[model samples]
Each structure stands twice: as C-alpha cells, then as structure tokens.
Target: MPAKRTALIALLAGALYLVVGVTATDSLLPAGARGGDTTTTARTDTGLVRGTRTATHTVYQGIPYAGPPKGAHRWAAPRPVRPWAGVRDATRPGPLCPQVASAYADVASLEEDCLVLNVTTGASAAARGHAPVLVWIHGDGAVGGGAYFDARRLADRGLVVVTVNYRLGVFGGFSYPGLEGSGTFALQDQQAALRWVRRNAAAFGGDPGNVTVAGSSFGAAAISGHLTSPGARGLFHRAVLASGEGMMDMPAGAMGEGVPAYPHYTWRTGQESRDTGVEMTSSLGCAGPDPRRALRCLRALPVKKVLEVPDIMNAFQAFAYGNEVLPELPEAALGQGRFLRVPLMSGATLDEHRLFVGMAHDAIGSPFTAGQYARALVTAFGRDAETVGARYPVTAFPSPALAWSTVVTDRMWARGTYAQATAFGRRTPTYAYEFADRDAPMYLPLPGAFDFGAYHAGDTPYVFEDPDAQKYFTDAQVRLSDTITDYWAQFARTGTPNRPGLVRWPRFEPGGAVPHTQSLGPDRIGPVDYAGEHRLDFWRRLAGQGTSPAPRPTEGKEQMS
Candidate 1:
C-alpha cells in the first residue's frame, strides 16, 4: 500500500477504535480490599448471592443472568443459567467476552462464559423501598465489558443500577447462512439480561416495572435497537441514548479510502451478515457446500483460533435486520414512529468526532494539513466538497484537523442526532441535550496535542465513578458531574430529567419555532438552538439539492465497528 493509503487506513482504524472503545478500570473497590460487608445478599432467580456493602452503596458483581454462550451455544440466543444450589459469591466481576486489544483500546479477553451482570443499589435500598431500575449497557460493540463502569455513584442517587456483559465481536454478532439467531445473538443477550432484571429486580429493592435502559455510543445504538425490537418491548419503560448512531448514515471516505457510504451505519440485512459470515467461513477453513456443516465447523473451533481471525469481530459489529429481534432497520422504524412509546433522553457531545480525528492525526504525530483537509472534504462529500469547504473554512478553526473534525461532526453526528431527537419528540416525550463542556476532562490515556472538546463519551465519567477522573476535574466540573448525575437519576426515577432545584429542562417539540435542546456545560445548562448551532439546515439543504451522495443500501465491508 502507498504511504497515504496506509495513513488513511490507520486513521480509519483509530477512529473506529475510539468510536467503539472505552477505558476499563481494573477495580472499583479500594486497593487490596478483598470484599465489603459480606452480609449484603440478594436472591436472584437462580439462587441467593452475597454482595459487598459500602458506605454509600451495596454492589453485587458477576451475577450470572444467563447461561454461558460457549460451545454449541456460541452463536445461539442466550439461555437461562441453571439454578445454583447455595449462596454464590458476587464479589468480583466476570471475565470479558472474546476480543482483541487495539491501539486505542487496551482491554482483551478470550472468555466465552461472560454472560454476567453487576447490580448496584443504595446501601439503604431495602429501607428505601423499591427504587427505579436503570440497566446500563457499555459501549463498544466488539470491546469493553460491563465491569468497566462503576455504578456506585448512580446507585447512590436513589436508584438500582445494573451493568451487564453480553457477547462481543464474532461471538456476539457472527452470522451463518442458516444460523438460527443470525446477526442477533448480542441483542438476544441484552434482552435476556433485561428479562433477568424483570424477574429479580425486586430482590435488589428495584422496581422492575419502572426499568430504564441507558448507554453511550454503540451501547446507545443497541438501546435504539431495543426501542425497535419486538423482543424488547415492555422490558424497559424509559431510555437514554448518548452519542448514538441510531439515525446515522456513513459518508464516502469518511472512515477510509474505498469505503462506501452506508444508509444505516449500525445495521446490516440478514443476507449481508450471512455473506460476511460465509466469507469468514472460507477464511477459517470451515467452508463447505452445506451452510450447516460450515457453521458447525466454525462453532467447533477453539475460541483463540476464532478470535485469531483478523477483522472477524469488527465485521460482525452491526445488528442484522429482517430477523425476529429486529424485523426492520431501526432508522426506518424511528422515521415511521414504529417503536416503543417510552420516554426518551437522547443527545451527543459537542465535539463527538474530535476524538476520532484527533486519534487519527495528532495522536499519531502526523498533523493534518490544509491540503489533506480539502482532500478529505472532496473524498467525503464528493460534488458538495466546495460547498462544505466554503462553509467550514480552515481559517475558522484552530487547526486543519479540528476543521475536518467539525465538518464530519456536524454533518454526521449532529445531523443524525437532530434527526433522531426530532423523530422521538414527534411521538414521545423527548428530552434532548448537548454536553457542551468544552474543557471536560480527558479520561482516556490517549497521547495527543488535540483538544478533545467534550468529545464522544466524555460524559461517562460524570455518570459512572472513575477514580482517576477526579484528579483532572476542576470544582466547576465536579458540580457539573453532580448536576448530570442528578438529571440522570431524576430521569430514571420519573421518565423525565427535571427537578425543582435544577435548571428546568423543557420537553423537545419538533417543528417548534425554537427548539429546546438543553446545552449542558459547566457554566451554563439550558436550552440552545441545537439545529442552528450544528448547521443542520445546511445539511438538509445539501441533501435536498442532491449535492451529497445518497448512501448505499449496504456495504460489503463496514467502515466502523
């Protein structure tokens, strides 16, 4: 490959890693501490499990919600775990699902029996009666597990929080021509966990009927899938989607060279998934005239051998449509208002694509030049390159990289966010927000000169407790964290993120004279003209005038996982 091509591929790979990746902490407990108060116990559907009790919260870790998806169950839908006889120790988290480490993400694992969940509740949860349940799904379709997030802070806010681990990468999403659960095993795993919550939440002093599903990035996209999935209906009464790609469509050359645009960035038709799986089978030495035989051979392979296949995990990151779990594309379902009528809170960070762009250029010590920026616009927007360039001139930004980041951020992230918010607002009670804390702390261990201005997943540390995050936060940021946590807790409790003391968050009204998307910054937290700020009108006009290329129905290879 040419130098430029290699750089482009590296750039795309880094961007994909940042989009799906999240920092994983080793332990949420104090260093060297074996366990907390051992008397804290909850009876799960399987059996009684002992948990740890801290000053603020009671945590039950590594509680199996479903049977291990190993061996013959590798690509099959999740099943219930066999009931245990005695009190099980829920002191440590389970191993992560199968995945490989990358430049941006440092976590890796080959464990297939990772279908477990962690529950956190206030120390006085039993005394507080049944608190609302918040089931959290971690981001990164191929990497990162539920244990990465510490839900103690959220749990302390008078709610029962549950973080779950399902399958990841090929284990989660691999599809064969005649696979029974083609392209939906991960989703099935999530649904199974939710069902577990419904059955056993009362044991943890949680109100199962008032469950809220929440996540960021890929996890948010999964929540979007749940919103449309018939299997997920009534499992969650509320939803929170942060930096989700529910309505996102990829642009040409946006991810890498020769990468075509996709109409649905996070979805694949069953046929497309099966095609990718067939290609994988051929590469894995499991190809045969019969699809069933090929699938059996693939499933029989060792976990390490299966994971050794390059790009296998990322290839199956997308959820497959035309199946029972997700009968149609989530984007189409949202556009047609054919989804669950649950209250929703959806938003994105101010600089959603900066982390991707920064990791691509600045982190790698290759500063993006003005020439490269111009070429990127042409590559991404095609005939509308001139118009896009004119709108986002290099002179307006601090650096060429930032300028390019803004272009994609506005065109891709903001436009999709606005569309999703509008779609949700039209039919359901919707609350839209923008995490605009430009100086938010950078929690990821990324070495770069780039300014990550409230980049993608920046708000995660605020909602979940990260021990190292406090050292980077100022007093104002700490207050901002509290406010965000309060808002989320309120949303989880009552279907709305409003309270008497906090800044009033207005419900999103589509087509209103002035939109009410709350801009969440350290200094100011109130409604802002989100559409105007992101120049959604320009994008709508660009699409209306047919300057932007129409997204292809499906792509042979996915650009981002």
Candidate 2:
C-alpha cells in the first residue's frame, strides 16, 4: 500500500510538471527574452537574476518573497507577492525594516515595504548544479535588524546564501483584540519565506531540502521560536542558533516578556494579548473611541508615525506560553521533549550579555560591588548563585563586572542554550559548541572599560563573511569565516557539521567529551566549555520559580506632599 501511494504521488508530480510546461523561472521572464545576456541568469522560480561578477561569486539582490505588510495589512500574516507582469529588477537590495538610528541603519534604507531577501552564490559552483542553501535571520533585540548580511564569503565556500528582511517593531509585531488569531505574524513571515525557498530554491540552483536557518542573538532566539512554532514545521531541515533562544523564563511584566502582557498594563481582564492589543493601540494614539474602530484608524496611520513610537510597538515581541502558536514556555517544552525535533547546532558567545547590561548600566545604578553582585545573584538564582559564583568567582574572573556578566550570560543564553541542546539532543541529534574567540567585535557599542570580549552578535560578520569585517579582525579573522562557513554548510547538508580539514564537531550528548565548537574572531579556532564555572546546579534550583523579589512600596515620580 505504501509503495502504491508513493507511486501515485510521483505520477501526480510528473503530470503537474508537464502541465506547467517549462514555465520561466518561478518569478522571472523567458530565457531568450532576457536579452540572452549570459551574465543575466534564468531559473525556475526566482525568475531572471542579473548577477554582478565579484572577486568571489556572482550576487543576486532584493528578491521579494512576500508582499509588504503595511497600512491595513500591518500585523497580518504575510501574504504572497502578487505576480508581476514583467521581470522585476533583480539587482540592488530592497529597503530594510525601520531600525533605531545607528551606523547600520542605512545598510538598507528604512521603509514599510521591506519584505525582501538577498542571495549570493558562486557562479562556477552553481553552474555545476545544486548547492546547499543557508537562510540567515538577523537578531536586533527583536526590534531592528536588516538583510544586508553579506554572503559573498559563504557563497565562495560553495553555498547559496540568502538573507531576509521582515517587518519589525509595532508594525510587524503589534497584537490586539482586533488582530485575533495572529500574534506570531513575524514568525509566520519567516515560515512563508522558507516555503518560498522550498518551491523556488531549485530555480536558484539550491537544494531546498538541504536548507539551514542560521542567526545570532535575537536571530538565534527566533531560531528557537521556529523550533517550536507549528508554522515552521518542515520549512528548513537544520538550524544554527547563535547566542540566543526563547528559553529564558523572565517575568511577564519584565521586557514585555517578549510579547505584550496586557493584563499588567491595563485594568481590563480576560482579554488575550491580541485582544488587549486593541486597547494598547488606541493608547498609543490610534484614533477612535470604539476599540474596533480604533484598529482601523491604526491601519490607516502612516508607517512613519507608527514607528516613531517604538516603545509601544515592542510590546508584542513575546509570544504567550499557552498560545497555540508557541504552546509552552520554551524551557518547559524542551524539558518535556515536546518541541519540534530536528538536527540543531546552537551556542552562545563568551560574554553574551555584556552588551545588554552595559546599555542599562546607568539605570542599574553604579556597578554592583562584588558582594552586592553576589547577593543579587542569590536573588536571581536563590542558593545556586553561591555555588555558581564559587565556580565563576570575581576572584577568578578579571573583574567584578566580568563575573557579573558571566552569570547573566550563563543564565540568559549559555546555560539555557546548553540545557536546551542537551534536552532536545536526547531525542534527536544535537551538536553543541561555545564561541570562545576573545577578540570578536561587539556589534553594539560596549564602553571601552567593559572590554566586551567575544561579546554577543560577534559571530555574524564571520558567518555572513562580511568583507568589511576585516576592519575588526586580522588576516586570521578572515580565514575564520571560511572555517565557520564550511562547518555550517556540512551541518545543513547532513545532520552533523563534521567535515574533513575543519575541527571535528561532536554530538551534544550529556557527559560526553566537549565538542571543539568553532571559535570566530581574532583567533578563530579551538574548543572550550565554560559551563563548569557557571554552576548549573544553582540555576537549575531556581529554574521553575519566579525571580522577582517581594514588591517594595514605591514613591511616584514627583511625589505628592
């Protein structure tokens, strides 16, 4: 019976292929019609792409996989792009989502219409036939990130690399009573892009089945979200989550819990986050008194004004643990062995949170003294902070700030990621590594005194093989790009990242010898596991409990006499 079913499906596929009748690449024009330009390429789905000869490979830019989510469509599940009457320009990058004003803001111009992706592949390599695909999801605290991630180096390594831009901030993630049944829209967009790949990758000379989704920091967190999102099933075969995941269980009220906690914000009760999203929208100046009418007004507002209020938009970054989309807290789900089981490679940088804590230092008051920092550790981890601290003491670290940063990093990323990899690896194959390169550039500004050694998001340039990244590393740093790309490509092709001529990557089994994880930076090779110094016993003890201390009586700003 199974054989018959397979034969039937194959017959149907063949018939469908015949009916399609050698149509132009999915979104491109006919071959000869494209001026018969050899440098201009033709494929099945992505259409005719004109590639520019580069030092390493030809590059394709600004391909749209989904329609822009703007105006009335804001916050809706991403929609497929309308078929164009003519071949769309397959040159230059599209705009990126609105980002915080910064040096990188102009990597691609900011705009509402930014659902685009870029691909770079070696001309000679792709000419040989199918190549592996690598889709990158950038992390920007879940607020701002773009698709300018360079892939020329990775492409030179013989992979077809794609980077995507999705909606961000309130426009991309807003939830409200009016927008019911759609809290994970951004994640939905990612899955949509993956589906597009499965259908169109062949046109670009890529193997859709061999695709790997990779990201750093919040991008890593999104990778974790995808691991659990039902919508993401089968979109990609393997994942690389660098320095972030959705597993950290912070209080819902803190940091919007990565999504809105409407109840804590409004007196209204019993409304789902999306339901309350309507109320929050009006509070942010979307017009109309009636909540439903207000959402329409919101839909009509200019994207500029909407983005002007970022504090309001970032509210829905978190997904409800009970929502059908998310199902459960990431850690809880992973521990119970209920997550989407797939081959995964994930890890954190040496000092993942130095950037976060540094940004909020003034607000946190003067740096905590060694003793005070220890006490705060207990507050965060209960008795485990002591044991963890003993293992990673201020005495051992270069400074108190270093010790504090390590604790936070372990709790938020390293240990959580390790525990996640170990737990999920039990049922499925898992490979784990630690990015121990000390001289990795901190993507965000870290005060000079902090010495953000191998801080969060440092691996992106190396993975994307951004050429300008040379400013950050020496000739040795550039080679790390080749090494890391090779490891990633091997993993995407098979379940394991092992390849000849590179460091042997080990499966993440409990109590097994540590895998020599790829270290990318000033010195880009070697393996190290700092988990022992982190004292997992302490963190595990406080794992399920709430971390907030007793509510303290507080004075309002401008205290009344």
Candidate 2 lDDT over 32-52, as tens digits, reads: 123334455545354555555
Residue 74's lDDT within candidate 1 is: 81
Which candidate gets the maximum lDDT versus the true structure?
1
Identify the runs in model 2 with alpha carbons over 4 angstroms from their true place: 1-39, 43-49, 102-110, 141-146, 250-272, 275-280, 287-290, 321-324, 359-396, 442-447, 511-530, 541-561
Q: Write the per-residue lDDT of candidate 1 for residues 11-59, one digit (tens) a residue.
A: 3443444333334455534211344455577787799998877666778
**lDDT, residue 73, candidate 2:** 73
The TM-score values for the models, in the order shown, are: 0.93, 0.78
Q: Which stretches of candidate 1 lie over 4 Å from their true place?
A: 1-25, 28-36, 545-561
Model 1 scores what on Cα lDDT?
0.81
lDDT of 2 at 164: 77
Single out the weakest 10-residue window by summed lDDT for candidate 2: 1-10
